[model samples]
Target chain A: MTKEHIVSAFDRDLEGIQATVMKMGGLVEEALRGAIKALETGDTELAQKVRKSDRSVDELDLKVKHDAARILALRSPTASDLRLVLSVIEISAHLERCGDYAKNIAKRSIVLAENAQIEGTVPALRRMATFVLSMLSDALDAYIRKDASLAEAVIERDLEADDMYNTLFRSLLTHMMEDPRSIAAGMHLHFIAKNIERVGDHATGIAEQTIYVVTGALPEDDRPKKDGTSITFKPSDE
Target chain B: MTKEHIVSAFDRDLEGIQATVMKMGGLVEEALRGAIKALETGDTELAQKVRKSDRSVDELDLKVKHDAARILALRSPTASDLRLVLSVIEISAHLERCGDYAKNIAKRSIVLAENAQIEGTVPALRRMATFVLSMLSDALDAYIRKDASLAEAVIERDLEADDMYNTLFRSLLTHMMEDPRSIAAGMHLHFIAKNIERVGDHATGIAEQTIYVVTGALPEDDRPKKDGTSITFKPSDE
Candidate 1:
């Protein structure tokens, strides 16, 4: 085959991979929202949906890898084409883990919702989850569009999720301290914040991978600053 | 260069990268143990040591990547050799993150040990840390030796650490419930358990990478059971 033919073939494979990943990302995003809603509204049906949908994410993960490998074996791509395949595989793996974290949150939400008193800090948990989901969506978009700048923005936004998680944990701890009866619910909330923080971290990982795929260089850690309302990403070089 | 010379050069480069990663792993293990000791005995000096030594691990990470890239550019390896280099680069990244987690734990230990009365959970944390360190060590060994079975064993052992973390979190929660005054300390301990759990997850990631490098397949979820004791690895037919 001519180089042009190979390039086109690889591009088609990558497009397929990206489409599958975006589909998976959409499912994970829904799962995260459903998990939080399950917690907020005590919707066991939503939690069950999140649980059942997790298998689809996992199956998509395997399919992406299988298809990527077939492309590699048949085409024997080189250089950037090869890196793109590897990055897709790694990115899909990270996204699958994000789904797993969301599923964990859904399971915990079910438990927390079952409790009678509702003793935990709910608003902080919701805020953190929202920030995490936003980051995930932005990061995936940046990857699909090869938008290094947008990926950098997603990386910057991760700090907001982290800060919110920290605040949520502190609030939960305080609640448990004031009323020992809040321990079970408060601990569940802590796990939820932790899962959200991890989702944000996975989003950052995706952003980093996007940067690598686009520029072949890892971006330096550009810590975002908190201004009470939202965290702003300021690149270190800037 | 002849194919034989190129192969030898790649082998030497792989060995060099493997050596640096193992050194970094050892340093991280020491840092994890030091952090636990600092928390258990309130040793700020030890925590300081861990925090300071982390820079060396970061430096090693950069050095490995540079060496791997240089080898790739010079030799232009194909197929399995290419996969090996890519896996090394990715594994090094994971190892760097593990080092970061250990440093974070040590930093938190300094503040937590200052006022927290930690009595019953220190041993569990230490034990879990030790288990993770061993798993990491074995995973590295499996990579160097190209031993898929050994890598599988390391991956299976992660369940033990997970169980320990869940139990530790529950016990700490109960303690916080019993004595509201211990809330801050208890939360700190909970974070420590979390760090250890993350360390185990990183180890598992490394093990999976090792297996992938050897067998060219990703392991299924295979999370450890909840008993904190034994685990089995069942390879998927796909």
Candidate 2:
């Protein structure tokens, strides 16, 4: 084969790997959204669907990781190519973790669906999930396009999600205090917030991976502070 | 250098890295135990000590990871040796995460010490922390000794810790429901149990790393259950 042909083949492999990782990311985001929606709507069927879908994410995780490793072993590429392969592998792990967090939320959703009505909890969680999903999607975009600025934007967006979680946590804590009957439900709500918070964390991990791929440096964790103030909702704002 | 000398030199480096990882593991276990003790006893001073000691764990993590990566890049070892180095890197990440969880517990203890009495919540949390500490230490031992069976045991022990978390969570939820004033304190206690539960997860991650090092095969999550009932805990005879 010509040298140009060989290089093109390697590029194609990298593109294929990136595509799979993005697909996996999409599946994880969907799972998280489904799980949170199930909790919000008390839809056990949706929760069950989220749980079953996790297996596909796991399978994709293994496939992408194996394929990346196989490419590395065969091509023995160095520098940028090596970084690209490594980033794909790491991002796959992060996506798999996101899937696990979604599964955990689904498990808690099933329990919450059984006892109490989830009236006030789902909105906060959905907002947090939306922020995390965008971060993950943008990070993947930055990675594919090699856009460092876009990766930095994802890092910056993570603070907003953290703030949302803090607000959600305090509000849920107050809700549980007001209604004894909703204590179990509130705890479940708290866990869902936590899962969403971790989803943001995993998104930040993806951003770090992207930064590493671009600059060969790890990104620092720069989560915002909550300062212990309770978030009170305004009815007009909702 | 002669072949014998070269082999012996590599062996010494491997042994040194293993010893350092074990020492770091012990320090992490101590930090976990001290943090939980501080929480249980409401000792801010002890909590401060645990927080201070975590710096050393972080330093050890950096050193071990660097050494392992250096060995991998410089020595270019194959097969089992390569797996050992990779496992050390992953295991160090898990250990560092465990230390972070310990630090989080210590930080919470300081806050809990200020306002609320956590006497009822601490014992169960301590039990779970102890279980995680043992699993972490045992997993390190299994790694150093190449005992797959022991690593498997550590994996099995994680379920017990998970059960402890669920029980503690339910009890704390009940406490918050019984008295609205206890909500903040209960939340702090809930976070403590969660930190220990996370420590157990890190221990399981370490066990999986150890297994990968020994056999180059990753273990399944293997959480036992039957007929929709999670077999994570048996009713405590206490």
* lDDT tens digits by residue: candidate 2, A108-176: 777766676646678778778888888888888888788888988888887788778878777877787
Task: Report the Cα lDDT for residue A166, model 1.
Answer: 62
Error of 2 at B100 (Å): 1.9
DockQ for the candidates, in order: 0.28, 0.31
Q: Flag regions of model 1 displaced more than 4 Å.
A: A1-7, A63-83, A117-120, A222-238, B1-7, B62-79, B225-238
lDDT of 1 at A104: 73
Residue pairs in candidate 2 whose N, alpha carbon or C atoms collide under 3 angstroms: none
State each model's C-alpha RMSD to the native.
6.0, 5.2
Question: Which candidate leads the pack in DockQ?
Answer: 2
Chain B TM-score for the candidates in order: 0.87, 0.88
Model 1: how many Å of interface RMSD?
Answer: 8.4
lDDT of 1 by residue, B99-156 (tens): 8777767766766655657568888888888888888888888888888999989888
TM-score of 1: 0.84
TM-score of every model versus the real structure? 0.84, 0.86
